[model samples]
Target: MRKKTTIEILLFSLIICMVLSAVEGSVPILPLDQVKAGMKGKGRSVFQGNRIEEFDVEIIGVLKNVEPKKSIILARLKGGILEEAGVISGMSGSPVYVDGKLIGAVAYSLGTFVKEPIAGITPIGEMMSISEKRKKGPVFSPQVPVKKHLTLDELFMLNKDFFLSKAVFHSEGRALKPLSIPLVFSGFSSYAFEQSRSFFSNLGFNP
Candidate 1:
């Protein structure tokens, strides 16, 4: 009787841990229906110097990307509300939530120094799709017991400093001698760089 009770208690404890693990590993991507054009919301952006800043943003519009329509929200730092922040140099991956539902994350800048100061808001769900390795399958391999693997977010963050260095070069273009600065002096936002690469390539720019 004592052995049976101990086993039962252990089994119940295991069940609770499994449930919590599933919830912890899962990421919430905003449902398509929950997002729309011109939605107003609050957003959080991580900037240079490892600082996080929050702001108010308005959804400018949605662009259809093959299948998923992407949400593009424009934001102004709380301090610069009226003039427009133009999605500062290092705010990519900012999370935008509307009425408590996360709608999208800051993906890239639409253009440079535009008067209206708009930034491209990439739906978190859409960006998530890029990081997804497989379709219609369990996220883990059954053959091998699951151990903590690098998450898309974690991997990207680890490479963040490298990305920022690239951004510095792109800003100055010709005058900015790539060799003039140490590798540590520059950076690139993955979101912005990828966006530019895609946009230019689509227009027939050379590789």
Candidate 2:
């Protein structure tokens, strides 16, 4: 059966009101270890004009150890505004559910300029760890809180120093990096964005 109900919730951000919604009620989360390829699912996110909408997701497979203990799940998306916009950048962290069971968050895109709506999902297990860390404190990794109003470039520079300091003494003798943070650039044209990429990259950002 297809679900057609829409629930809207207002999310107030720094500069705008973003409306996000999901189906009401509790949904059991599917464990990462039990997720398999070919399973069908549904994901929810804001697609057009701040309206929350639903989309389809079909699991392709799980890529293990993509970065240390971390893993990524590949899934092809369909339906809703995805047919028009493809996998959008702002849709990151959209909740994905399989058989009414929560599976993961839409975290990455295959690339720009793709005809297909393929996305990389961050497993619920890994996402939960991030939430747990946040609960323990606002300061992730270094236990030091940064002051407000720092730009994206400034944050990257601070994080680079934090990672280097940890690399010096990790018991495994390897660097322990933090989870990736989303970087959003608004109101920039292709030429301007390209020109500014190097400026951000030099500050230890991937751009």
- The candidate that wins on TM-score is 2
Clashing pairs in 1: 163-187, 163-188, 164-186, 164-187, 164-188, 165-186, 165-187, 166-187, 167-187, 167-188
Candidate 1 residue runs with Cα over 4 Å from true position: 1-28, 66-85, 134-207
Give me candidate 1's TM-score against the actual structure. 0.46
lDDT by residue (tens digit), candidate 2, 48-153: 6778888999998887776565777778899976777778766766889999999887766665565467777778777565445434644333133233433435
- Clash count of each predicted structure: 10, 0
> Total clashes, candidate 2?
0
Which portions of model 2 show Cα errors greater than 4 Å?
A: 1-27, 137-207
Clashing pairs in 2: none
Worst 10 residues of 1 by lDDT: 176-185
Global lDDT scores for all candidate models: 0.44, 0.58
